[model samples]
Target: MRRATSLLCFLIVMLCGTVAMAASPVNADGYYKGIKLCGRVKVVEHFADIKVKVVDSFPDLRVKVVSSFPDDVGEWQFVEYGEDFTVQFVESFPDIKIKYVNSFPGVE
Candidate 1:
């Protein structure tokens, strides 16, 4: 009985660790300075990523990096790393979706 109980506890711990590792590292409600470009992503200017200036209202448009892109949503194109953009935190899934463009939108 003692051996069986010990084995069950060890298995439970291992299972929990696996589940935690499988989840994304991005916080659902925290500001993010950069994201790993798992898929294509639009590279914006440094200031553009800041949450205060970018997010106009509540429920800001921040996002976390997922292992795979969503089938229903669009994908980003440009390649940018580090704090090139700042993202406002959001309280939902599918944080942000964008399509690649040849030029910046609304710029002449």
Candidate 2:
């Protein structure tokens, strides 16, 4: 019985984590732009493809950028200026990743 209870607790926690990871709200004309770390300078890997989407889930959007040279890490913020989302900044380099998943109803 104790083992079963422990397993149930673990499963619950895992489910919660998954939900949180995918908590972005749905937007039909929404877009997300982010940079992903391909590899270190010594590794020399190409940047991941820039992803653009509309009427899709946030998880489906994977925007990344890579370069041969190293970039400084920083915080990235995305604010809904008009009808599109934009890459604001990054908190770190070689591992920069951001997701924009909502629209400002009346930002005009």
Candidate 3:
């Protein structure tokens, strides 16, 4: 009986660890920066709920959007990655240009 209890405890710990890992997003700087290309083009269901995670290294950036809208609401926007970032909407809402301030990481 004691051995069975110990085995069960070990299984429980393993299961908890797996759950935690699955819940956490991967942090990769480059990956997050890459997603920046999506910018305004990405039609996120809840743009206000967007989360960006940036780390010192390119391999430590995470981005996610949590929204209460329906599952089929938002479509991920796609744009080309470049030094300068620009967002263009289909309508005549005016374009948003993001000037490339710097690229050396750690800049404000």
Candidate 4:
């Protein structure tokens, strides 16, 4: 019975570890890796916080580029510096996929 208990403990530990290591694309509260989706965003060549791919349709988020007051999900203003987050555009292997929308922008 002691050996059986030990085996059960090991299985439980392994299961917990796997679950903890699982990665989600975004947080349940509409944040990506603890960074809020709204605000000034900067495009960078390298060492970006997020790698993004622009899609014509079926995107993970619908982004609307605004001039100011990016206070909601998927509302971003392009800026040269002092950005809330930086993104690198890539054709493949993106952290998140987005679509440019004129209206009603948010996480999809």
Candidate 5:
């Protein structure tokens, strides 16, 4: 019974660690589930490809709005149509939390 309890505890710890790592979208390629983090973005009220929350601190991504050439990670160009991806702003339960920055845009 003691050995079984130890094994169960170890499994729980490993599962918790996995959950923490899976929460962050930051990666070497800056892509989340094959969606590039940069490019033309469209803001929508509903049915968005990505849901983002604006936060003052501890942002998952630092986003920069650009006129053109949103090639870098977290650089986004607002578009009316033909957007690379669509996003919805929400007060809670965002898919990714973002901080708007003038420069140095990227995943944190």
Candidate 6:
């Protein structure tokens, strides 16, 4: 009985960890324009195509970019605007990744 209880606890912990990791946001230093690619995205050994879009508002009829793409779908970490940034665009998905203060950044 004790062994079974311990195993159950371990499984519960692992399940929670997996959920948290999946919910984690995309890792990026900051937002930028003109690049149309995420600076933090590491070049994979195998290349997978990803599509994204920039929307006007959140919960504003735009689907999550990652969900739409099967290959490049990953967690996205939204951050506050700052200087010294470049912008990238996902062609198919239409969920805004970066939000700017002054003007909308260009995405290719």
How far off is residue 5 in model 5, in Å? 26
User: For each candidate, what TM-score against the reference?
Assistant: 0.33, 0.28, 0.31, 0.75, 0.77, 0.29
TM-score ranking from best candidate downward: 5, 4, 1, 3, 6, 2
How big is the positional error of residue 30 in model 1, measured in Å on the Cα after superposition?
15
**1-108 in candidate 3: lDDT tens per residue?**
999999999999999987754443332222223433323233322332233322333312222222222122121224333212333322222221122212222111
- Report the lDDT tens digits of candidate 1 across residue range 29-95: 3223354323444344333443222232322233233334421121222344533233443333334
Candidate 3 structure, TM-score to reference: 0.31
| Alpha-carbon runs more than 4 Å astray in model 4 | 1-24
Candidate 3, after superposition: displacement of residue 105 in Å?
A: 12
Candidate 3 total steric clashes: 10
List, residue by residue over 15-102, the lDDT tens digit for candidate 4.
Answer: 9876643444755455888888889999999999999999997677789999999999989999999999999999999998889999
Candidate 3 whole-model C-alpha lDDT, 0 to 1: 0.32
Model 4 residue-pair collision total? 0
- lDDT per residue for candidate 5 within 38-102, as digits (tens), equals 99999999999889999999787899999999999999999999899999999988888899999
Top candidate when judged by TM-score against the true structure: 5
Per-residue lDDT of model 6, residues 37-77, tens digit only: 32223222223232234445431111223212212222232
Residue 77 accuracy (lDDT) in model 5: 98
lDDT value for candidate 1? 0.38
lDDT of each: 0.38, 0.33, 0.32, 0.87, 0.89, 0.35
Give candidate 6's error at residue 37 in angstroms.
9.2
lDDT of 3 at 27: 24
Q: Which candidate comes out best when scored by lDDT? A: 5
Q: After superposition, how far is residue 83 of candidate 3 from its true place, in Å?
A: 7.3
lDDT score at residue 54, model 5, on the 0-100 scale: 95
